[model samples]
Target chain A: MPLVDRVLLGPGPCNPYPEATLALAAPLLGHLDPEFLRILDETCDRLRTVWGTTNRRTLPLSGTGSIGMEAAFVNTVRPGTVVVVGVNGLFGVRMCEVASRYGAEVVRVDHEWGAPIDIRRMLDAHPKPDLVAAVHAETSTGVLSDIGGLAQAVHARDDNALVIADCVTSIAGMPLHIDEWGVDIAYAGTQKCLGVAPGLAPFTFSERAWARRVERPSTWYLDLGLIGDYVSGGAGGGRTYHHTAPTAMIASLHAGLGRILEEGLPAVHARHQAAGAQLQDGLAELGLKLFAADGHRLPQLTTVWVPEGVDSATIRTRLLRDFDIEIGAGAGEYATRVWRIGLMGPNATPARPALILAALRSLLG
Target chain B: MPLVDRVLLGPGPCNPYPEATLALAAPLLGHLDPEFLRILDETCDRLRTVWGTTNRRTLPLSGTGSIGMEAAFVNTVRPGTVVVVGVNGLFGVRMCEVASRYGAEVVRVDHEWGAPIDIRRMLDAHPKPDLVAAVHAETSTGVLSDIGGLAQAVHARDDNALVIADCVTSIAGMPLHIDEWGVDIAYAGTQKCLGVAPGLAPFTFSERAWARRVERPSTWYLDLGLIGDYVSGGAGGGRTYHHTAPTAMIASLHAGLGRILEEGLPAVHARHQAAGAQLQDGLAELGLKLFAADGHRLPQLTTVWVPEGVDSATIRTRLLRDFDIEIGAGAGEYATRVWRIGLMGPNATPARPALILAALRSLLG
Candidate 1:
């Protein structure tokens, strides 16, 4: 199956670590078994280290990133809960959508597609939003918002309002200091900077955030409190069955987390930065303009303007079919205007940028 | 990883086909890539066949089986929806819990843990109920409900009430005629008789069931209608983004489905039957009593009464740590009274019974 031999340079789901894939092939273990419980403990420890937090209330949700996004709100947001969701791209918009489903009255703070959200405006708009959520990195637009400042702004308005950040693209890619950033809750996917295949969503909630819950979460499956009790050990330190966890996927994530820590989170972040600079230089040499603003652009996911009069889809098809390479077509306002190239995870290397650039130049020129 | 060197005899997650694990090592693909879209088409078509339904609404939810169970109700049950749920095991109780989260007015029909639900009473108790839900196979007690008869009985009382089923342990293990049985909605996990790793939830819904929706499914992540539109190709046969699907998990499932089709459904069911009978014969020879009612037990999962004064947990731990074998602990009313020996998936073999029996005999004899 690996013989498909395509270079993945997409918005997310950058190529996973080879070790991660091998870990996936490892024999399955029952979720409640002692061996798996040990693995779960190690996985959670590694997650905490990379997240730059010591929060004990952390574990991977048994769904993909979107459900992880849902977990943050579904477990905290109740009917009549006022949520201030900042919208910069598709994922930000999705937060409002998911929150409203749980009966939250969402006040959306709209920002430009390729720009970081306006923190001051967001705090001013919703003085006492129950949950203030913003994407730490918008994969759709390749824009990275300043979560530290956002969290500070949120608490300045309402001391009890929880600050939630979507770190689907930013974790292990760039610096994300959860405790230092004052983020009360955050959720991230394994596919991006963690160099693991996409299946589980690693999430954490601060003690302050956990204490503020009004009622039991509406949903049963995604209830963090119930799941926490099961994972942190049921009453008297024994696990109660939560759900049949995706064993192989979790194993892959565990191995991926191990590699991240081995490399050190700061070093992984640095590699992504260097790779981003390499792609930026290559694109500039090709006479292409970067889509996101210079200062706020994400180092892992780079966006470039589609040359005028060139069909974006045609280039993508040719890249995949002929060159065995994959790049992402844009979404929303930028759908026809840009192409996103990812240098996340194991794909975050200068060689990847060089190869993709050569393929693109041959096709475009 | 399979070199952990243990034979799995759990209720579900029975030894997956080796090919499924290999497929997981395949290189990553973008969720919206053309190649993946083609793969998605093939996977859905294969699932439809296994489910014995022509319903185009079939697809694998991107989470574990519990979400699949949630999908049936979340998509249809609205606030104040009347739901008649029959309980005989832990999974039945799970159905009641999940359905209630969707605001369903659940009328729980209780039954003995090891006996089939009283269908006549269930139908008569909730006359004209909006929905009738039952478990086809109770993994906790190893009783297989007569779904075809139950479907007829539910319709006899309320023609409009949708008949839903938890086919987690039933699908592919034994005969299941979805369309012929008139089951409006059915859901299953991959790790069961399907012989795939645990991650994806393969599910199906009838045309009549699909047509009865009032408001959109309460939750977004498990919303089948939106996911169906995306998988079926959005407006104008164009695919749209839903959730970032777990590429490796889906690939593993695709390969698992291929193995099932190659074996052919009836032969697969027959294999399970043979394995079940062998285990039954061995258990009877050991002078152990089966827990479920005569002529009503599931072939895939066999429940046996634990000998008086034998610590079940100690035996389970010894079987795993000493003999490199894993079976299941009992649940609910049956807890401390029985052990669930699974013959599901590829592990359902006459040889498997012989191995487990010898180990049990050596332990007890």
Candidate 2:
């Protein structure tokens, strides 16, 4: 079979780092191999530094980004616990569903799509909430919420309330200091800003919030407390068998994280901001309107309203088939009315944005 | 870090096909990429062929073998349902734990370790069991139970009972006819016989078993009802987003399954049987005894009793460190009494058995 040479500039899963490719092909090892265990510990330390936390319970959840989000609720929110969640986009709505499925009394704070969430409205709900959750980067609308302000409000109302954020699309591309921002739990997917394939998700839990978890998590595959014990040296300094860790993906993430640290987080953030602005400007030049609110948009993912004369879905298909480029069409209410183009991780390069702009110009004409 | 050049003679994670490694490094596509959707369809087709059933509900689980097990129960066994589980080995014991965690009233049929389950006894005492589950190839004891007979008895007692099997260590290396054998649901891990890495798990559910599921599964991550719809081209012939599919691992499984079909399942089964006999005979000559019951033992994984004089754990450590070979040490009751050796997939070769025997001879003598 011939290899597909199309570029990935969609919502996520942009081309992984070249070193990640090497890590994927590295010789296989037993999950319990001493060498592999050492790799796990080292990887955890690096993830800690990247997550900007000293929390020891930090580790990668075994499944995808959604599972990592599920882990946050299943492990922390017990039955009958009141959770206040912001429902502005698809992701915020997903958080409510996940929390409610876990038996939480979800209190939703609604906002218009493509607009920033109102932290004050979310925090001023009746019946004091135990958890306040929102998406740090709402990928669906390309809007960024104020996590620090939400955290401050949650604590002011009740120091016991936990603040949770989904940093899946923002980690390496934005300024996110999890600890300083008071995010009790935050999960990031590897496919977004980390330049890795979409599998393992790095999620961390704060010391105070996790102390409330006395019962085992409902989902056996995603039992964070047990997985944490196994990943960090197990009982009696020996690693107990948890689920078989996805060795190839974990190794790939280790390699990807190393590249992230070497380039440095501050520099990576600057590159994303610059590249995002250039693409947004180019879209404006083509008479396309940006969908996200002006003052609080995610730089890494830009959503643009479909112009009146063009068939939006047709343009997306033509870009992929003819130009060998892929961009995302908006979902839910924004479907067929807007297009989401991502400039994340390696795709945030100045040259790549130019290529996308040129391809758009050629195809639109 | 230098790669370890050790031969995996342990119970699982045997050497994978070189082609699988190359496929892992293949250029990644977006989860919804047209090329990748084609790959997903192609992979589902190959999996259906390899699994020996025309069931359209078959696909690889994104997590490991254990999550596949979790999915089997979570999808079929509703809370408060009665399930009869056969507990002849560790894997069977685990089936009971997973079922009970999902709130099933699990009635366990106990058998001594290293023995096949008594099917008559298992079916005779049950208040109309909703599900009857057992291990096809128990990794811990190297015991192969009679899944066909168990399925027959399960249906004879009550046609409503779903016959579930754990074929984690037996899939491509054994005579597993899911439809003919009456298994409503069964899951297999990639690392064992499929010769892929240790991430993806391929499992299937019968139409009846899935139709019995009406309520949404508690786990958002392992919800088969939703994930199945997403994989089989969701409503209106467009795939709905469920979670980020593990593209690299899925691709590697696709490549590995292709190799399995090219070689044919019968040839793979025969190779494993022959190599297992060779390893058993060599161990017997070296003054050891096979632990599993005669005539019912698994050919890929052979559990052996440690000789009276030599320390079992010490020998395994030496085999790994000195001879670059890894073997399994028993847990629980057989902790220091047995060693489990594997000859599955790539490790089930003519020359590899000789190497393991030679390593044992040198280390022991």
Candidate 3:
């Protein structure tokens, strides 16, 4: 296939900062190299800042956010544990699936794909779950669940139960207070809001989550207890070699996080909100209906319903081929009924709003 | 910490191609983007060529090489499945640990660290284990096991028993004939001989192994059968969607593989061999004892026994602080007795060998 520049306005794989790319190209270092450790240390320090927590277990898992979700569940819920998952979108359902795979008794709180999670009902359903999990921003449907509300509800009933949140689509572009909201564990991917390349999943755990990790059944590779020790001067002090980390990806993340700091997290969040509103306005003017409920849509991603008689694939293909603009088709139940337009990271700009509007106008008309 | 220009002479995480790094910085693309899919297709094509296999199941697993090892066991060996693993190094021990966690009835073929795997003994002891696994190059002790010999022995007894080989330290730099040697399932990392950033694990399987994948019980995340379908043409025909892929990492890998192809695989292998010899000769002149037997040493990594009363950590620290050169301390049994010097990818240069020798001579003297 011939190479062509694309305007990414999808759920993820947003445009990256040039510096982040350059950081990736910097000289390779060993995973245990002192220099690389310094980079890891700095990256973790920045991660804590972005996550709004003082959790020492903050680090990047060397996989996508789905793996992050797996890491969170595998570490938190052992066999026969009771896991309550808020299932309003695809990611929440995935969390439930992962929890069940680990032999957890999963109780999913079902809601419509584009609707916000009902925290009260989730809390009322189960007597006491071993863990409560939800997605902060559901990438599949562009719905932002009330993470703070859910965390409160989960803690009010079962203080011992962990609260895990999938922040894959929210992290640098939204208000995520891991400490303030009493979340035990949270994870985010680089490509979405972090504006780095996708490969590393930045994750953090509160002290409560860390306490549970120590007694969890061992999964050799994904063992957080072992990984924490290895990272925190355990295997003979300094960086103990666990598995080889993706150095280039981490470097890119460091650069992306640096950009985040430079722009200031609040300003970045505001920009995402502004861009999201602009895109939503444009779509509405073009007779597109927002799939997500009002006041529940994620600022980073917007899911719009595919009008009747129009094939989502054809519109997406035409957008890519004719306009060089890429948007995401709905996943799961909404596969043919929605198109997710992302205004995330570098793509969350006024220029994207205008470009997407013009392309959709020509195509829909 | 101040950044310094240092030569990486360790077990993997060696120098990467500059172009590969730049490729990593390219605009982030969605995991299922058509353009990204084309790159994934190209990456699989290149990996197949390098792995010396025409099996349709060749692709990169999304995590580090350890994940590749886990995926291999998870997909092939279900609970109660008998798996015979050769334990001569850190990675081999890790393999046993991972397999055991998955409920595999793990049988061990133990050899002393720095010793080559005894194929005859392993086969005689196991007779007909469901799976026979071995590492091609034991990174911990720099020993190169007889992979071809082991694969033959495993297949001779039970043609159905899968032969799993860990090619992490010896993919492009050494001779690995997956097809000719009858290697059913083989996994490798990019940091070693591939001359790329570390994250993705390049893996391949024989037709027989692919069949085994179908019969395996379902796993939510590491289910290769499901992943293969999503990555290859899924139920959606040409459209494929599983987890979000690391797009930039794939791009870098593509460029790295391209560089390897441009140089010719044989030529790259020859360079590694020559560099290994040069390193060994220089170390011998410095009165350093080779950890592995001369003929069994891996071409990519040379483990040298530390001299009497010389602290390996102290020497390694000095090398890093004074010479800006990085090497590895012995892991497991050789923890304080040896240092692993790597000659991998672009780092397998005469300049690195000379610099490392000079630095060691200064420190040792």
Candidate 4:
């Protein structure tokens, strides 16, 4: 099949900003070229602004957001280390799986899939744990949790414990203050709120987290320490050679971040918020029921229960085949029962939701 | 620093094919879109042709070539599994490090830095080992070893033992026959000879190797079993959502492979060979000495020793700043003693080397 134009309105990879799309076609640069390194440095500086952190180790990992999750645990989690994970959606469950593989004693605080994390329950699950983890924006359920509140509570309970946040779907679409929230480690994807193609993971590590890192991570490629030397570089240290970076992907991400900052972070967040509200209101007007908890619902990703007697897969196929639109099916058990509609990045506008709503209304009628 | 165009004559990441560069700007596609999946499948098929393998599990991994190295060991090496690694250059030494990190009892067969791997020495180093590994093209040293001979000899010693080859720099620039030579596992990079950007790793696993894979590896991201399900799908099964793939990078790789196949594989290899010979002859005429062992030097990358009292870094800088040309410095101990001149992919022509030779005559004088 040949490539076709797509309106990516699913969970992620929304149509990128025009500048970001064009950046991918820029001529190749040697990974170690001085000019390319300058671009890399500037790119990292931009990453810090959107991530809302002063972390010196902030840079983009070569793989997607999932690799970011792996790097987080592999760098710090060691044998018999106690990790408390808040499990409200698919991403939280993945954290448990990844942490355990690195010999972490995982304590999971399970909640309903479509509900926001219960912070009190998570803190009470395992006191004095080495690390506490939660997702700020759960893509699977389209629920947003209070990461800042969770971090404060965890630090109050055990000040030594590190806090890790999965901000894959929240960085640019929402107001995230990693430093103010006391987040020790965080990982995000470029596909969603960043308005770029999915390839690199925007990752960061605080000084405290870096100080307590494991001496040797099991996976060499995802080792944060080695990658940091090449990407962000240490104080008074020159950049070291690691793996060949995906130069074109990084350039595109740099352009995407530039677009977000040009629009202003708060304004970008406001746009996403307005688009989500429009989408939610329109879904209700169409007689559709929202799946996530009412107050904690995310604006960028709106999950709605499949209407009664309506075939979910058939509607999705028609959406793609007839309308050239792409939305995501719910994960795991909710696959057929729920639909996730995204208004992220460049797609975060009132008009985008209107197009989807009109198409849905026509197809259902 | 404003994205200046350059002639990338580096060891890897030579200028990408025009088609591949344009493909990166193509509109984004959801990873699971049927059309996108079809393109991915075709990309994998193209990978098989270049890798010279018919393995059912062949696919492009999300990360670069180094990630491919990590996946190879993390999937197969169990605690105390005996792995014999032939160490001649940087990548081979890296394989030992990765395998050991995965708890393999690694036995090293050390060779000179610029010499090809001795298959007899590698097999003799560890009798009855679970796996035997070597670099087919040592990118750091610009030397090529006979993986087919190594595989045959390793099989003769122990039929059940897997034979692994690091073909990162050999796939499109040289003659590689994985199945024809009984190689059980192989991994390659897209940056060098594939005429693509450095983001994806072309990887394959033979049935025999897959049968003996460890049940649960230390990494969740690089797990072949999980990745294969989404990329190549099992018999009568559909692609299960693993993680969001780098769609743009995959599309670019697909277009790159298309260009290579269109030109014919043999023609591509011959071009690289001719370019290397021309460069080597020109360097000799200019009183320069080649670094790699005679009869084993890689045709895609020609390593030449820096003349006594000559500064390596200064020459490289001048080439980049004044001529807009980029070349790689040697790795590790030979970092300042050798210069690697690559004639790869779109840059594999006699004219490319001639330009570099003229530049060198002016600068060195």
| TM-score on alpha carbons, each prediction | 0.98, 0.98, 0.97, 0.99
Better of 1 and 2 by DockQ: 2
lDDT of 1 by residue, A102-128 (tens): 889999999889999998889888667
For model 4, chain A alone compared with the true chain A gives a TM-score of: 0.98
Q: Is candidate 2 or candidate 3 better by TM-score?
A: 2
Docking class of 3: medium
The alpha-carbon lDDT assigned to residue B249 of candidate 3 equals 85
Flag clash pairs in model 2: none
- Weakest 10 consecutive residues of candidate 3 chain B by summed lDDT: B212-221
Which is the leading candidate under TM-score? 4
User: Candidate 4 on A70-148: residue-level lDDT in tens?
Assistant: 9999999999999999999999999999999999999999999988889889888876899999999999999999999
Score each candidate by Cα lDDT: 0.87, 0.85, 0.85, 0.92
Clashes (N, CA, C under 3 Å) per candidate: 3, 0, 0, 0
User: On a 0 to 1 TM-score scale, where does candidate 1 land against the true structure?
Assistant: 0.98
lDDT of 4 at A144: 95
Q: Where in model 2 is the C-alpha error above 4 Å?
A: none
Worst 10 residues of 1 chain B by lDDT: B1-10
lDDT (Cα, tens digit) per residue for candidate 1, span B191-283? 999888889998898889878874556578887767877888765777778888888888888889888899999899999999999999899
What is the per-residue lDDT of model 2 for residues A50-86, given as tens digits with 9 covering 90 to 100? 8888888778777778988888988877789999999
Which ranges in model 4 have alpha carbons more than 4 Å from their true place? A234-236
Error of 2 at B303 (Å): 1.1
Candidate maximizing DockQ: 4
* TM-scores, chain B, all models: 0.97, 0.97, 0.96, 0.99
Across residues B172-258, which tens digit of lDDT does each residue of candidate 3 receive? 988779999999999999988898889999989788887776354334667776677866776566645778888888888998998
Q: Give fnat of each prediction, in order.
A: 0.65, 0.63, 0.67, 0.82
In candidate 1 the C-alpha lDDT for residue A105 amounts to 92
